[model samples]
Each structure stands twice: as structure tokens, then as C-alpha cells.
Target: MRTLRASVLARFSARASSTLAFDSTSHLDSLQHTRIQDLRSALFKGGAPSRIWAHYTNILNYFNYDVLPLELHQQVLRQCSPPVRSVRLSDAKRLAQGKRLEHRHLHEGRFQAIISNIRALGCTPSLDDYHFILEHFAAVGYHVGCHQVYQEIIHLGLTPQTKTFGLCLQAIAHRLTLPTFEVFRMRLVSQTRKALDDLMSDMRRFNVPFTTANLDLALRIFKETVDEEGLNKLVKWTYGIDLDNPDCSPLDLLENQTTSSPQPFSTHALNTIIDTLGRFGDISKVVQAFEVLSQPLPQAKQYRFSSFDDEDDFGVPVHVPSPSNHSLPYALPNTTTYSMLLRHISRARHSTLARHYLIQAFKLDRQ
Candidate 1:
């Protein structure tokens, strides 16, 4: 998902989008293509803003304003804008102390300038273009900007894609979880719930299965809001299960439901479930999940060229028509898994249980 990729990349300094939008760039010649790419790279690779802006003029002249695809306009606007790095409270405070424009305002100005840049390029902003900026706003911790851009998209009657909701939801979750936001907790809590619910509902209209990244973001939104009802609502939405199924627990919904999304199994998802259970003082469920993780991964014989033990697709020896003894290999728990469990056990302050997990982790790690 575009939303997922953007969120992950936000941790690092912002760079140009390597991916292009769903449009026609095929008409452009190789020279034109390479020039656009060079401009994109130069945007963040270190250069003066004035020179970058000038390069934009050269591109326009080079194309002679012929066949300016929406993607080119979008990338130009997207790249020419400033980098969206993490904004700390300290940074905000530092900006407030200055008489110049605020830090966030500087961010706002660049975005507005890019919109003007789009018009200068004789291109109307497409839905994908707006989504790019919305994602950008979300990345820089400006939930309000994300909401405003989203509203404009709706007002323009542009039907949003799934990534649209993902960006807004992720923005809300990221902003609300900040320590600085705690003071306004009571006022924002109810509003956040309604807005989040609305976003989810809007996303469902597309009738597409949520990507695992989006689902993970939803999990975070529910957790931060502490909405048990919403948690069950997510379970109902993803899987056909609800509170009516008393035997079913949220942990069961931890799996990636749609094959179109993340991997079938994620140790991260498992760890989150384990951590949630521990938070609820549900020690039994935590232990159950841990035991499942602790189970020995199935082993199989490794290939040995000297013995001619390698097998073909049908599991027959390549050199001979004999059945291969090797079995399918599986992934085992990694250091991260063991580290999460160890911390969880340590928090409960159960020395014997902690010792057991540590010893098991020690033995379980092949590395």
C-alpha cells in the first residue's frame, strides 16, 4: 500500500517517490524519462532550492510543454516541496520562540507553493496527486492538514482509494499517541473515535480487503483509543466473527486475513497480541501465545552436493529416480521474538517463568 510505504519511509529523511502513479508515461522518450528522474534525485540529493526550481523550467522547456503527464506534474510538485521529517515538540517550541514564520507554517507554505507550481505547469491536481500531498501532510505529523486535504478531495467528488483512508487513520493515530497531546486527551478522545469510525466506513465502500499494513494501523488506532468495542468491530470486519462467538478471542484475528496483504504470519503481529494480552493481565492467554511461538520449528535434511541429495520439484533425486529424504523447512523464532518475550516475562516479575523462557530462547536460537 502507498500509505504503508510512506509511513515506513517517514522514519528516514523524506526522499522522492521512486514509484509513479497509475497514468501514461509510456509516450515519453528515454531522454525525457532520464531527465525527470535526475531532477527527482537532485531534489533531495543536495542542491539549492532555486536551482531545483530552475531545473523545473528546463524540464518544461525540454518537453516544450508537450505531453505533460499528470504524474510528471505530481512528481514535480511532490519533489520540489520540502522534506517531511519528524517534528519534535522541542523543534516546535524553538520555532515559537523565533519571530520568523513557525516551523509548521514553513511546512504549510511549501505545500501551498507546490499547488501553485502544479497550476504553473498547466496541470490540474488529480486524485492521486492530492493523495500524495495528503500522505505528505500525514508524514509530517499534521493530522489537521490531512483532514483538510481529504475534505477537499471529497468536495471535488473524487472517489478515494483505500490508501486515502489509510493515510488519514495513520495520521490520527500518530498524532494522538504523542506525549504532548495528553493534555487535550478528553476533548480529542470522543472526536477521534467518531472520525476514525467514519474513515473506516468510507474505506469499506470500496469493498476491498484492507492491506495488512492498514489493518495494523487500525489495530493501533483501536489500541490508542482503548476501544474494546472497536477492536471487536475490527474482528467482525476482517473475519466473520464477533462477540457472539464467545470462544473466539482477538488473538485469533492476529493473522493476516487477506492474501493480498502482508505475509501470512508476522512475528510483529504476534508480539503485539502478546503485549496486549499482558497489558490486560491475561497471563494465561499470553503464555498460550508464547508456547505457540516456542514450539520447535520442523527440521529437514539440507542439500549435500557430494552425496547427490538435492531433489527436483517433484522431490525425486535429480541424478536418480529415488525419493528424496529431505522435508520442507520452516522459519524459526528470531532474536526479536525472544527479546519481546523476555521483556514481557520480566515485567510480570515471575522469576521462574522468566527463567524458563530465557532457557528456551537460548536453546531455540540456532544462531
Candidate 2:
């Protein structure tokens, strides 16, 4: 019942936001100002959740849902369901006072109840509102709550935006990291698989394409769960290759490029992909990814350590081989790439492989 009411109101967040889309009179502004101020006070001044709740109810009663300004309502939403960053600060404060953070149901109930109340007042919640709730939950540690909110959005026949899918992927990935949830690891992986299926269906339904961010979230989950097959599918997806085709080469992305074209894999982006593969204990793939990036354009005066022990710490000549591939992304990995590879390779207990990377890193320090 609590979840139901929250879901109902969750929809209204969107509707209520745009209700007075173009204009709000002085009458509306004044009514919202006091309550918004009070809500902000409670959040920042270390007021108890009970006090925050009090200010919240006052806002509801003051506007009667009919004249609730979007700013005020979003403020209440922040209090009721903060993103992970806010939750961490609030929790830290609670810990200092030797109190647990507020109970889950209080927040869940309040969040949905806001949506329900908005709808009861005959304001339809907008899609933006639904995304707000889901995004908050995605960050707030209510990983599954993101799904619950998403389910209700669908139940109400609401069309979600691309960001919604990204949020849902984030939520799905988060649970796999929690120690308390480790015992349910397989179940969490399965949940991600289901979310992926739902995402594909929705993609077709709305004609919305999935973004790299979406693929990255799913990759995070697969990385945690050590789901090699799952990682393979997404890695293929990430490179714009067909899942069923065996003939595709990641190198194809480089080959199709025009000479001197824009480098597709910037160093930071390639490092992220390398890190993802690293997480999967696939150092070979990591090295392949690193190699695939066109070596950085050589500096006119290349620098290398005189030797490992030379404390000079200045640029010296270190000749780097030029790329044979005429068309490839001209990005090169940095020390971080070395660190990621070493971390994962060491994790697999292969000291020799780790040592090889350290040597490679020492050789590449000219960058």
C-alpha cells in the first residue's frame, strides 16, 4: 500500500512541475517562498527528519496540490528522496549524533504520497517527475526502488526518456557492489539481465536508441558479477558491432575511419573501457584495447627516465614506434591505464604479467 501511493505521486512530480509551466503569479510565489525556505532550513540546519516532515506537510497543505509551484515541490522531493551525495552527508551527520539515518518507509511513503496527492488534486504527473524520482533512488541506495518506480511509470502508460533507462541501469549496477547484498549476487545479476531485456523492449517501443552510458552501466554490473558472456555481448554492443557476427574486429572501428580523422577513443575514454575489461580479469583484452588506440603523436623531443634510479625526473629521449594503421583513433593510454591493468592482473595472481605491464609503463612515461 505504501509503495502504491508513492508510485501514484511519483507520476505527478512531472505533471506538477509543468502545471504552471509558463507563469506563476505573485500569489503562488509568496505561498511557495515561505515553505521552500523552511524546507531548506530543515535540510541544512540539522533539523530532525520529523521537523523536515512537518515543514513538508505544511507545504502540501498550503498549496493544496492545485497551486504547488514546481520549485517548492522539487525541494520537497529533495528532502523526501535525496540523491546519494546528499544521503551520504545526512548519514554522516546522523552517525556523529549516534543515530541511524531516517527509516526507509518514511521516505518511500512520503515520496509516493506526494505523487498521489498531486494526482488526487487532478494534476497529472509528467515524465520528468518520474525520472526525478528514479534518478534520486538510483543514487540514494534504493537500487530496487528505482525499478519499482519505473514499473509504476509503465503501469500508468507513461513514456520514459533515455535518461530513465540510464538511471535504471545505474540502479541495477549499484546493488552488485554492496557487501550486505553479496550473498544475493547471482540474483542481482539476474535482475540486471531482466532490466536489459526490459530496456531492449522499451527501446523498440519508443524508437529510442540506447546510449553508451547505458552500456557502461550494464558493463559495471557484469564486471562485478564476473559474467564473461554478458560482458562479451555488451562489449560488442559498445563498439557498434553485431552480437551474432563472428567476423567483426574491434579494429574495424579504426579501419573505417578516414585518414587523419578525429580519434574515436580519447585517452580517458579508452582508459574507462580498459578498466572495464580489467574488472573482468581480462588483461589480454585490456592490452588489446590499449594497443588498438593509435599511439599518441610523438613529441618532437621525446623523454624517458635515464634509468629507473635516475632521480633527475626530466625529459630524455625515448623513441616510440609510429603506428602502422593509417586510419585509427589517435589516443594513448596514461599511467592510469597501467594501474588498472596491474590491479586486475595482480588480482588474478599473475605476478609475471603484472611485471610485464610495469615495464611497459616505464617505457611509456614520456607522455
Candidate 3:
């Protein structure tokens, strides 16, 4: 009886699939107009939303249905307004599986379909939606996909938050192609720099606030892509650290800006910027960045530091949390920071200075 039941269920599933296929084909062949109302009603009549979406995409391709277009996919979403939670979850799962399977193109095709569906529903995609799409493209080095999502956010009049902006910078960075020939390298680098400039201009237009994350990502992008001019521009903006101007110093910016509002710096951003400057053998700028990094973060939340003074655990060895855990404004130099400084000194052939930094690093660790 159990074997018979299983057989019957399998037959029923196959029959249902065949019946739906036949109906979809007939509808497509019979109608030149292919009204969206009918399309939506037909596609969603049987299966779950995700299944329906996947099936319909395959059906459209199978029939070579040009009349339907991408907009039809959107129309189904707008008319039905199927809960996107499951669809998005499924998308993430597929992407993860695709990565393991080495099928990036297939993953992107599905993602494009998902985006079309989101747009079709006449619903403004949230920051999370945009971020997910951007990440998919960014991970695969699909720079065009990243730009499309960025444009869609702007079209919806949504300002990308700092994290989103950082992702955008990273996506642009991935477009960079390093060439062995100097001529090709120059051309490629120039184009990338222009693209980056345009992205920054868009950020300004959208009123996206420049934060430590943004600055750090931008600096890393420039460093990786070998865009010295871009790096210089970033340094000047973040800390007024310009190599061409020997007189320029962090102290000058801090003291002069006391009369104005000084921009708050993050230790991570300072570390990355200093590390990059050090790579270029700019000892003075590296030192300046360290000075800034070591200073107390004036803009940090005061309540966080206030807890440090509380006497609730008097004589008890107080457990101090790292910057990430405690919400402190600045972080002390970790091992990586000292390593960068040592590398900088060594690269400049200053064995004496490198040894000095190495010893300092060890002492700090012991303390």
C-alpha cells in the first residue's frame, strides 16, 4: 500500500508539470499581445512564488518569447506582490551553492531575474536588497552589475549609507586591470581613476556621508589599483597629508581646525592611510598618521569611557574589550600596525629604524 501511494504521488507530480507546460505553451502561441494580467494569473496559478518565478524564466527562454520582455517579469511581481523574503533567502542559498559549483554566470543570471522582479513589484528595493545585489556582482568582479544597482538606488532617491558606499568603491576597484605594458597600464589606470572620480561625485550628489569605512575602502582601492594621484587626493581630503607640500602636517590641520570643526578620525582609517604612505617611503607622513591615530577620539561616545572609571569591580582585574566590542573611538596599534612600520623602515634600507620599531612592538606586546 505504501509503494502504491508513492507511485501515485510521483505520477501526479509529473502530470501536473506536463499540464502546466502545455498550458503555458498554448497561451504563448495563441496570443500576440500576451497581456500581463493573464500572464501573472497563469504563471502563479499552481506553484510556490519561487518555483513560479524560476519556471516562468525557463519557459520564456524555452519559447524564445520576445513579446514578453523583462518587464513582464516585473509586472508579475507588481500584480502579485509575492512575499520576497523566501525569494531573497533562496537567492542567497543559490549564490552560495553556485560559488561552490563554480557557476558564477548562472548565479548572476538568477540575480538579474530577482532584481527585475523586485523592480516589477513597483516597490523600492531597500538598502539590503541593493547591498546584496552589489555584493554578488562585487564578489564576481561584475562591475557592470554593481553600477546598475547603484543607479537603481539613485533612481529611487535613496542615499546609500556608509557601508553601501564602501562596497561601491570596492566594486569599482575590482574593475581595474593591471597590464604589463606601461602604455596599456596607463590607459587602464586612467579610465579606472575617472570612473572612481565619477562615483565620488555621485556620492556627493546623493549626500552620502564620508566616514572611516568609506575612506579606508577608497584608500585601499587606490593602493591596490596603483592610482597614486587618487591616493594623494584621498590623503589630502582625510587628513590634509600631502607629500608634495613638505610643510603640510597633521598638527597644522588639527591646530588650524580648532577654530573650525575638526573632522573626527578613526584609528583603522589612520592605520591604513599610514600603511599606504609608508609603502611609498613617506616616513614623515607615516609618522603624522601615527600621531593622529594615537590621539584620543574626541567625537567618541563619552558614556563608553565613563564606564571605565566606575568602581563596581574595585581590585578585580578589569577585562578590557577591544575597540570593536567597547565602541571606543580609537584603537591602540595592533601587531599588524607595528609590522607595517617595520616594513616601511626596512624597505627604505633603514635597518636601524626597523630594529627600533621591532623592539618597540615587542615591548608594547609585553606591557
Candidate 4:
């Protein structure tokens, strides 16, 4: 039965093009003279006629990404009711599965048909369905499909959960070539701000569990807006409040001060901050943050090192020359220690200091 259904679906798709061509020529004169009233009258008189399945098949035939007139396309949507729309969508999905259809071609057809159907339904598709389509299109790198999905979400008055919103944002962020970034920044900024405000209000009013992931997304968008100072201020405010009152902040409950390793931030958040800092050439701030993060706690004295050979090598021991004190013993330098420091310094572009260590590395290599 499934195979039979699949075969019928394929046949319908094959015939769709010819039907579309015939409709385009025969309807061209009427379509050119058609008013919105005529279209509305056709839709309300008996939306989704028995002939709709055939009409849909014909419409699909004429649908080319490059050439379809938007008005005539919308008129076809007006002819379908919800049930017919659903049927058409199912047919589109089945047609998309054909091996001969390229990803781009399939995506364009499916996207246009799905969007038109959504318009006919007078409501948005469920979030799960929207996500499935968005992910499918995004994987194929169909930017137009992705944009349509985003616009549909907005048009449908659906506000996705933080995780879902974050995933969408990250997907766009990952694919942000320079041109795409510029376009996204211009097109999405206002919509994004409204969405962010809605999300923030939800978090504040409902006692919704705002995870680090949520904060990370907010941070990323802020970075995109080129508001580093604003981001830093927001972070300081939020973290300070959380630290001062653990009872009020879910994030505080997750903090682990006893662990020596760094806590993981969301990769999206970290990447955004790193990219922002790099763009501004604030290398010193990066180094300073690393230095502070690397510091040992007072209770961690047992983990701190006094000698380069010490197993707990958290702190380095180095001597500075003094004008009056001359009785200090000549310390035997650890070549391994010097070599490691040289590697770090070189990577950080402190070439002069690195060169001194490089000289010692050569001696150790000789030994």
C-alpha cells in the first residue's frame, strides 16, 4: 500500500509540470485581468474544490524558483482550504523525495508550497514542523528557505523557546559569511530585539528557568550588535546579582568554586566574545583574563609550585636582579620549563622574551 501511494505521488508530481504549463497559458488572460475581489470570491465561495488536487498539481508544474509571478502563485493558495492545503503539502513532501530532484530544487519547491499552504491555513504550522523544515533547508544551505521559515515564525506570532531560538541563531551564526552577516544584521536587528525583549520578559515574570545557554545566546546577539560595553555591563550586573544572592539565581546553583578547571560556557557565547575581542585587538584583556583564571585559590597552596620541577606547577619561580642583595645562589634553570614558556610567549607575540628562552631551549636540545 505504501509503495502504491508512493507511486501515485510520483506520477502526480511528474504530471504537475504539464498541468502548470497549460494553466499558465489558458489562465494568463484571466489572471492578468483578475482583481483581488475575484480571487477572494473564488476562495470564499467554496475553498478547496474537488478540482484543487489537480489545480495544485498544475500549479507545481509552473512553479520555477526564477520565473513564477507572485500574484498568480498567491491566487492558487487562495483556492485551497486547510484539508486541501495539507494534502498538497503531503504531495510536496513525497515529490521532494524523488531521487532525480536536486536538493536546491526540492527545497525551493517544498518551501514555496509549504509557505503558501501556511498562508491558506491562516495560522502557522506547529513548532516541530517548522523546526523540521528549517533544519532541512539549513542543512542544504538554502538561505531563502531559512529566511522564509524565520519570517513565517514571526508572521504566525509564534515565539519559540530559548533553546529553539538559540539553535536557530547558532545555525545562522555558523553560516555567517560576510555578505550573509551584513544582510542578516540589517534584516533581523529589529525583529531580533523584539524577540529578545519578549524572551527576557518571560524569564523575569514567570520564574522560568533561565539556563546559561539562554544567557549565552543573549550575549552572542549583543556581540553581533557590536555592543561590547553593553554586554560587559550586562554580564557584570547579572553575575554580580547571582553571586550576591544565590537563592534568586539558578545559575549560582551550578557554580563550582572548588574545581580547578574552568567552567564551560556555551561555545557560541565564547566564540562571540573571542571574536569581538580579537576584532578590537584587546589582546591584553584576553591575557589578563587568562592570568586571573589561572590563579590558584588560597586553599590550593598545596597545588602551587615553588620549583619548576614541582608536580604542582601552578606558579612559576623567577629571580629579579637587585642592586644591593648579591648573596643569592645561582639557580639551575629547568630547560623544559623555559621551553614551554617560550612556546607560550611566541604564540602571544612577545618575541623578545621568547627569543631569550629559545636560546636556552637550544642548549637543552644539545644536552
Which candidate's TM-score is highest? 2
Q: What do the candidate models score in CA lDDT, each in turn?
A: 0.61, 0.64, 0.60, 0.47
Model 1 agreement with the true structure over 1-367: per-residue lDDT tens digits: 9998889888443433322321235535766777777677776575665566667667767685444455555566656555555334444565567633221323466556556666567656687777767766665456777777888778767888878888887777776654454576876677678777877777666555677888788777766776667765764565333333423323334354433222344556555555554665556556765655434333322332344356776778666433233221112456776676677778878788889878887876745
* Better-scoring candidate (lDDT), 1 or 4: 1
Estimate candidate 1's alpha-carbon lDDT, on a 0 to 1 scale: 0.61
TM-score attained by model 4: 0.38
CA shift of 190, model 3, Å: 3.9
Shift of residue 310 alpha carbon in model 2, Å: 59
**Alpha-carbon deviation at 131 in model 3, angstroms:** 4.8
lDDT of 3 by residue, 68-106 (tens): 555554444432323334433544575567533221223
Model 2 lDDT, residue 17, Cα: 68
Q: List per-candidate RMSD values in Å.
A: 20.9, 17.4, 17.0, 19.8
Counting only residues 3 or more apart in sequence or on different chains, how many pairs clash (N, Cα, C under 3 Å) in candidate 2? 9
Rank all candidate structures by their TM-score, best first, as comma-separated numbers.
Answer: 2, 3, 1, 4
Point out where model 1 deviates above 4 Å.
1-80, 85-125, 176-181, 186-193, 223-225, 235-263, 291-333, 350-352
Clashing pairs in 3: 74-120
In model 4, pairs of residues that clash are 17-61
